[model samples]
Target: MEQNWDDLRLFLAVAREESLSGAGKLLRLDPATLGRRMARLEKSLQTVLFVKSPQGYALTEAGSDLMQRAERAEQAMRAATAGVPVQSDQLTGQIRVGAPDGAANYLLPQVCAAIAAENPGLDVQIVALPRVFNLSRREADMAIGVSAPTAGRLVVQKVTDYHLHLAAAESYLAQHPEVSAVTDLQGHRMVGYIPDMIFDRELDYLADLGVGRVALASNSVSVQVRMIQQGGGIGVAHDFSLAATPGVRRILTDAVSLKRAFYLIRHADDRRNARLAAFAEALAVGLRAETARLEAATAGQAAPKA
Candidate 1:
């Protein structure tokens, strides 16, 4: 049996997306055509590639095995078709980066914009979600996670250590009782993640505070920060985010400091792609620098003690 590069390409897409419709969107082909092509590929190889169901397509063991091989073939095809030097130079394709909303709103927009400016031909897409990305499903080419992942066929790199501090809008601080210390937080309205929706332990910023009430709560970092920016209530806010949220200021300067790290997560196999590797390196470096610079700017704000 013989196969072509296009056949392998189609198989890889279906395997990654786990649905003909999903693969069709990526390939700009209809699901029916994709289904027929998938059938032909399976017949040529004489193996069951995917188990189809009402829910969606699921890769069989044989399909998973072929996907791994096909990706390598795909890499070679790209490199051979165009001199690999194209990858070494300007990155000329789209890279989808999934990240938590805090980093997405406060950090990535600027950093990715800068990277895109540098690589004029590159298109950078940022996907902001509250939970861990499904990297195995190709939901994103890479992800920025608040904590390092311990298991998976993934490469995790520590991006940066960032700080968060209890903060409130200046207007809210002016209207409420002064909170000079952590002990003073009792009875004060708070803004925080909905306790049950906290996706990661590191994000449970208010867990230790023992605040009596959370007046405002949300799963989105952006929403929580915006709430504080709009004088909703006192809450822990990223130093980087505070720099951008002009109305909000850190309180209890000597207390309630939280440190967390960001990790750059990628598929282990993606490390072999020079273009992606270069972009990942650039992203990690830019993110670290941007986080530091913004945090420093926040620290320098004249009325940091809200």
Candidate 2:
């Protein structure tokens, strides 16, 4: 008997939706056509796959047995067809990478530039999501997240660790002379990243400091940084991001150093894809170098006042 993969697609759809009409809607087929396909699939396999009921359809024992294998096949098929070739010597394909806004803004540009330089034809899609991407569902080929992965199928690697420091505009610091230590922070106004929006663990570290009242709260770190630059109030900022922005002065470096790791995550199967592998390698190198640069800058700034 000839195996029909298309029938498996129809079978999986009905099993997932649990109703012929619902499956038809999802597959953009009419109920009658979907019913015919399911019947054909059951007949071809010589098995009763589903039992119809008032609620809809429930998978038979045989169908339940096949569901896991079928879904895995479907996922593999999707990964195989997600993109296309772009050049001769290079493996050209599109890679979807999800990361927080801070990484998207500060870290990814250098990584992207490196990928473009090495493989000009490769297309990269960067999705800036506050939460982790669903790698199992193929929502993204790779992810750069602040937290380590708890999921089983993913391959996670630590990219780097960086410090977060309390900073303010030099003018603002000059004015708030009393705000030199953790205890003094309670006397001053403060701008902070909204509770739900901070991705780094450092935010919690700061919360433990028992600092001053928040004068303003926002979800965007960029907004928090802008408010600080305009001399709104002191806020926690990554040392790397603060390097280029002038007028920001680090406050109580000894009292407020927050450190956290950045993680690079990808599905194990995707590691074989040339484009994904290349991009991951490039990203790791670029981020490490950037972290080193930031560490050096921080070290220089830590030197005693001349």
Tens-digit per-residue lDDT, 160-197, candidate 1: 99999999998998899988879888858899999888
Which candidate tops lDDT? 1
Estimate the TM-score of every prediction: 0.88, 0.73
TM-score, prediction 2: 0.73
Clashes of each: 0, 0
Any residue pairs clashing in model 2, and if so which?
Answer: none
RMSD of 2: 6.0
| lDDT of each residue in 103-130, candidate 2, tens digit only | 7776777778777778777788788866
Whole-model lDDT, candidate 1? 0.88
> Candidate 1 — worst ten consecutive residues by lDDT sum?
79-88
Error of 1 at 244 (Å): 1.6
- CA displacement after TM-score superposition, residue 189 of candidate 2 (Å): 1.8
